[model samples]
Target chain A: MNRKEFIDQLKSSLSRLPQAEINEIIRDQEEYIQDAIQAGRSEENVIASLGDPKTIAASLNATTQIEKAVGATSLKQQAGHTFQAVFAMLALAPFNLIFVLGPFLGFAGLVFGGWVASSSIALSVVAVLIAFLFKFAFASAGIFSFLSMLLFLLGALGAATLALIAMYHISHFFLTSTIRYLRWNLKLAGITKN
Target chain B: MNSQFNKGVIEMCVLALVKQRDYYGYELVESISKRIEISEGTIYPILRRLTQEGYFETYLQESTEGPPRKYYRITTHGKKTAEDSVRDWKNFVTSVDSTIHSQEK
Candidate 1:
């Protein structure tokens, strides 16, 4: 559809959507589309490339499990959600941290520090038993020597990411349940669903 | 795919989708309708729930064809909720699978 037609159709299509949301989306998208066109693309091509705006808009409205980009809120809302997210994350904080970070660090720390602390004793025993053999093969340089540093960095990074992920999930859990929670809270607090 | 399941998941699915990208109402419903079965009218109520819960906030824009249209955007709480739900879902699925088909035996 042409741009005007497309916007009209998009509007028609959006009738089923939340009215305020459709308006914001269209206004924002229109700016983006215009920007894209000004950057030297044909309006027709951009529109065509964008596909039917209705279809695009439809997908835009489809609420998946997690939400998309979130905006900064007023102090009141910011505080409330921050409280929710922080509290929620805090609720699961211990287990989430342990699960994501515990094992990897324990294994690596043990292998490294344990090897260092015991190496002298281990080497002395080995020297008496198989000194020549020990020299022949780089025994201490097993799985970790060449790869530990690299793997440790990667593992630490992975663990950090997992921690973040865990925190997010925990927060989401709280938020989801809190929808109903808020319902009751609001009712008690004397606010309706308006 | 049925209305019952759709009803159950509508809030979740819509919230999740918007968590990934901003979407208008009809756009959300239509997009989700493709992957899951839900009546066209089903989304509005979920939108109402999310908005009332402050998981979503809305604004209206002028339209060329008729009256202004309202757009819903996810609140920070909404985004957090979606992400957490997604994580929980993955965890739940993983645990169930592991329990059902663990190799320790």
Candidate 2:
């Protein structure tokens, strides 16, 4: 196929990426191909270098997670996911603080949040303890006394907070990078065309 | 770092090309290669992905050059995205111009 036809096909395929991921993938390909051609490469040679599409697609997925971890989210998709996660965490923060910081000794609202938070933390700990001590059955902890919800919450708060922070950062980075990448890419493509 | 990274922008380029005029796969690839250095197979995934994402829709047309060739057309959403991204690019370039490129006040 001629180069235009090939790109048309490629463009069609690229549209399938998540709205947030569109630019990150497209600009990279356009630049790579442009550079290769400028260096006097043949069509057959260029195609060969790109390798299998399916394999490339799979590799792209792994990179996306990393992109997310590093504040790589794009501006356009700012409200997409990381924001959602942050909000969700914010909503849960009250619960998390209750168990970890307040530990059931507080106002009714704080105590209520603590109770729920402690229950969740207890469940996680119970699962881990069961997996090790019991016959390696993780879910069996379900049958155990949800009795020590207070202790479980206090114990697990540190781990949960850390996990939440990690999650928050990844989402924030990924969404921002995607937005920025698309913004710049679209502009570059536009300039060359005009 | 890789062609995969360019897939999103490439898709926009494809849509832009078609906005001016429709082209087949081989022709599209040729036109793009003239401007950029990329793997030939690279465009295929971008095409497939764009189609999946609904930016550009496709239909098969009989071709005199070879077998029925697939034709890709940019959808409304695709055009909007391309335009928006282009606008975003201008802001970035202007910033870079003042902050990094420009020396004289």
Q: What does candidate 1's lDDT look like per residue over B1-105, in tens digits?
A: 434333234566788888777666556755876676444434544665487568898877665644455677889999999888778778977998899887666
Model 2: per-residue lDDT, tens digit, B16-44?
A: 78766666666787888677766555465
State, as a TM-score between 0 and 1, how close model 2 is to the true structure.
0.40
The candidate 1 chain A region of ten consecutive residues with least summed lDDT is: A185-194
What TM-score goes with each of the models?
0.34, 0.40
CA displacement after TM-score superposition, residue A152 of candidate 1 (Å): 78
lDDT (0 to 1) per candidate:
0.52, 0.52
lDDT of 2 by residue, A153-186 (tens): 5567567666555545554554555345433332
Residue A152, model 1, lDDT: 51
Question: What TM-score would chain A of each candidate receive against the reference chain A?
Answer: 0.33, 0.31
Off by over 4 Å in 2: A1-54, A57-194, B1-8, B98-101
Candidate 1 structure quality by residue, lDDT tens digits, A16-119: 45688677556655754554455576777655644555434333333211122123233234324433432222222334334524553354454445435444
